[model samples]
Target: SSEVQMPMQSGRDYSLGEYFVEVKVGTPGQPFWLVADTGSEFTWFNCHHHKARNKTRTRHGHGHGHAHGHSHGHSNPCEGVFCPHKSLSFETVTCGSKKCRVDLSELFSLSFCPKPSDPCLYDISYADGSSAKGFFGTDTITVDPQNRKHGALTNLTIGCSKSMQNGVNFNQDTGGILGLGYGKDSFVDKAGRQYGAKFSYCLVDHLSHRDISSYLTLGPHHPAKLLGEIKRTELILFPPFYGVNVVGISIGGQMLKIPHHVWDFTAQGGTIIDSGTTLTGLRLQAYEPVLEALTKPLTKVVRVPGDDFGTLDFCFKSEGFDESVVPRFAFHFTGGARFEPPVKSYIIDVAPQVKCIGIMPIAGNSGASVIGNIMQQNHLWEFDFSQNHVAFAPSTCT
Candidate 1:
């Protein structure tokens, strides 16, 4: 198989605050926008429409001038949804199949299956409190459907979600999620294995014009030679996440006094690279020291309450703020790998003449620290599964 590359668009224009790639699934190929999530393990689509019950409704069968209002269990089947029955190549996975018994054992429960030939069902919940209930199915998937010359993959595993909870945080234009996790059944693993067990992506600046697109590339087509000095680091597997080792963080070349346990994998905390999250989130133990060191020189700048910036604790008037004096920030990783991002990546522009800290502490100081998309902007990141390492380099993403 040859390399496959797809254009990615930032969801900021749609108020979604994530990144998405266009995918074509099923027979005759129906195009849908799917969130490119490395943290998710299963690729699924919204196969059913969510209707608001408990709302007022009217009945006209009585033929009299009367209004009947009540909540009832009535729903339109497959209306404006991804109906698997309509697809010519859709096939449900049996409960006894290898895909359901082994590859999907963690998500498919035996209690949900009464017979060996029953449809494999799955119910999964995300960290953001959103949940989906569905069954497993196989279908054809294509990258650029309009141009059939690229070809399509048949009998690929996918989730056919019947209902979704907590629909408020989702992008209305997005029809589903494309799982890029490290599992055997994940899209990345399947697609990457076809070429050279390698995949790469270069995220453009979040504030760039909509016409300027980022890209998700599969296979071994990364032009590392043109991107300047490439840094390689050992890849740590933390199950469904791409973990990286962080020794310390330095601002202006001065390392802060953060505890070692903050980055220790055994301490229930570590660092992972996630493209789904918008901002960088540091553990509480590591957040305080880093924040203090960054603000020491900002004493002369006007400080405002966090509420003004929404979730960000640090905010300052951008009128007299000089970015040159902000100092340089770098992350020291294992194997002497250092990542130095632009100053504007941390000090973000919000409202007019207002700047706030783009990095924040994780809620409740739990879970692993996340290196999100904002910190990774303007750089090409490559995952070499065959070599057991990850590489990165600066790129214009043109």
Candidate 2:
């Protein structure tokens, strides 16, 4: 099997926004910035509709580690530069096929189909009320391997979204999302079958300067020699999400006395590592004790009054803040993998002199906790699907 590794750079959209990677789609190879999401399964891109009345010409431009361009004065934005009709290698998957009827039925909706011979359409509704409607197709996707060699994967499954609603507020500059989930149609699974089932990424600090960048590699690769001691943990198999068994959490060396059921997967509570989510989320049962333990150590710091930033509940005025006093948090997972995140990862700066706890609490009794991108910063995370293990080490990603 061939080995491939690609260097990915972070996006400049927002500090809390998803990480973006440059990918060339279609035969002629038009570049686009795609959100790198391990929580999703289907890889989709905005498509240019020929019959659509409002058509805007897209001019490609490079900015902030991504190749993206935009145009105004049009009511509806053009899907993107690559049009399926223009791509010679593009092929639409017809409805009623095995891939469309069975495989896709589990991941997407087929309620609006008109005929069996029609293109396999999908309507994906997200938990945040964002939706994308599109037809399934296949085309070429090109990426630059770490060996400095250009490689193109042909006939890859992709969704050419005809319409999207309130999903990430995509403009002409933003193309679409690239799914890296464990589903059969995911890019990670497909590429893993062809190449190797190992991928690793090092995320820079979210508050890092725009010029600083991180890296993402596909296929077999080793961490840089300068990285700290690497830790290995079992990668729990959870569809569409990479889960890890979190046994307990500790603040300042004292473990919180949370219930074991809060970390049980069978009880609808477990921890999942997701790059799409900005902030880490915990169930109410686990969140309360963790928050209490965190706040107890910060008695010296003055709490900001009436400072609420949506999901973030803990806020403080950082006028004369000393970060050295902040308590360190350690997340203990099954197999004895202890993840100790830096204090800066939890106490994030949202505004000038305003810092808040980056983790949020999920309002449900039954749902998986999420280790969001912010919590994973400044660490090298490697996902080994073939071996069913994930490894991490502290690193200065930039």
Alpha-carbon local distance difference test for all models: 0.77, 0.76
Q: How good is model 2 by TM-score? A: 0.87
TM-score of each: 0.85, 0.87
Candidate with best lDDT: 1
lDDT of 1 by residue, 1-398 (tens): 57777778777677665677777888867777787877776788878522334334442233122212222434544433576755789888888787788778876434466888888888888766777788888898787544645656677788888777764346434677888878875777668656568888887777776676767877878543335688988888887898888999999999988888888888888899887777788998888887887888788889777687657889988997899888788888999999888888888876788888889888564579998878888788888888888788888776
Clashing pairs in 2: none
C-alpha root-mean-square deviation, each candidate:
6.6, 5.8
Q: For candidate 2, give the lDDT.
A: 0.76
Kindly state the number of residue pairs that clash in model 1.
Answer: 0
N/CA/C clash count, model 2: 0
